[model samples]
Target: MMRIVVTGANGFIGRKLVRALLDQPSLSGADGAPVPLSDLRLFDVVPPEVPAGAADGPVTVRCMAGDLSDPAALGAVMNGGVDVVFHLAAVVSAQAEEDFGLGMRVNFDATRALLDACRQSAPDGAARLVFTSSVAVFGGDLPEVVRDDTAPVPQSSYGVQKAMGELLVQDYARRGFVDGRTVRLPTIVVRPGPPNKAASTFASSIIREPLNGEDAVCPVPAETGLFVSSPRRIVANLIQAATLPAARFGRDRTVMLPGLSVTVAEMIKALRAEAGDGAVARIRFQDDPRVRAIVASWPARFETARATALGFQADASFAEVIRAFVEDEMGAPHKDPVS
Candidate 1:
């Protein structure tokens, strides 16, 4: 039997990840062997809504809500020992940029605190910790196509924080405090909620808002390219990052996940193809330099040979990304989203 912990459990990715884990029979242990999941603890700033059947189900589920910076809160989640820790909590891009202190508190300091907790008491061995990072970590004189080993020169506070977190994860794994793996993610598209403070929120809004039969704004030029993945691929890759044998990582613990390299124009084209010109007609372009400058700093293409070799995957095209949102969220063909 194993105990699992997922921080940021209230967020969309975190919630979906929890659901996916519930569907699983077991998870890979430190020994690289599958073990039955005995308990799952969801930790977040707010109480995460417990999915149906999880409470009385075979696997025990516990929901915890509190400030991650609070030792008492961290202690509650850290107690009883943990076999795997999926650390997904972070102050997103624009929000972080807007408040440096909050970003440092959540993304960096809290992350270090959690690692210390795992080091102090893990499941008789190091815990398998999967850290979700962002491509925003790459900036300034980036190669036309970023490689697995591209040096990160972040241009934003959020990027700097994530880059720092990645370093800590690598160091922790190196010190034998934890078996940590960092998966640097591309901008996720068609996120299922209303816009947050992320500068890249417009990426999802352009498609999601229109598909939901609403007007949307595009704050960046159509020519702006982005390296992106779907929520489905990210979840699968997160699980993959956790289960893969620790021996496979060797010295380097960071991986740039595979993603589609596409332009905003191409994305709109795909949206139009899927939902028709009506959807395209709904988007109004009015550039906001703040949002544009922040997003433009991120590298838009990568050669994820390492991630691919490690069994990770990416969406085939932007069209597939749209289809996934429609299938998973809308639950039916849009036929006429504009009605």
Candidate 2:
């Protein structure tokens, strides 16, 4: 059985990925089918919440909680044989900018350390590494639709750190130290949790607030557009990145993910349509200069032909995204927003 190690196992995407990995069946080929729960090593700052019935079987689960920034901590975790490593731990954009030092240490330095550890462990070169990057890598002067070939001009400290990590991933892959793939993910909307420090937190808040019977403030104008994906879709893409045929990617080290580009107005409209006018009434516009400036610098749309050609998929529309969040995350009757 191939042992998989997932960093950030307690995080939103990380937790979901761990559950998915645990549920995978053993003896299944990478592309053949899902692997079972018995073959995973989950690492995070906090222990993940395992399913209630998971303890009934002969599954092997190693849960380690520690600071990933420490070389010794990572060494201990990477000591055992690892077949794949999913790097998802990082400081979000807003928080990263707030503390540049922490951002560099966790996002860039820790990532580099992890890759180094992976290289040292696999003396024969035997593990696939998937690095989760962000669209924040592109900013400043951007085209209306960013293409796969677009050069990244990161505007925030977080973006710079992620972009740097992508470079390290490419360098490591080129040296044959690890089979690395970096995916530049879009802002995941309707995230299932309390508001995080990401400037994009508003994207999820508009949906979550209405669900919890509270009002949400839209910091950007109605016409402000941005790229977004649902958490489920993001997890699917990450899994695909790990299992897809290397031949499809060719020499490209990083791939842009396909995402829906919508404006705040469009998002509110979708939420209102699904929940009701009363829900819409719960949302009001309140602009914050810092958030507005940061969000405005981000690319509103992307042309991800490369990712599409490789069989990656995205949500069809923001409405469908809202519906998926309502059904999957909220678990409530789909209510139409009160107009």
Best by lDDT: 1
Off by more than 4 A, model 2 = 26-37, 49-51, 332-339
Candidate 1 residue lDDT tens string, 224-299: 9988999888988999999999878889999999999999999999999999999999999999999898778778
lDDT to native, each model: 0.89, 0.82
lDDT of 2 by residue, 154-189 (tens): 988988999999999888887788778899999888
Worst lDDT run of 10 residues, candidate 2, spans: 21-30
On TM-score, the leading prediction is 1
lDDT of prediction 1 = 0.89
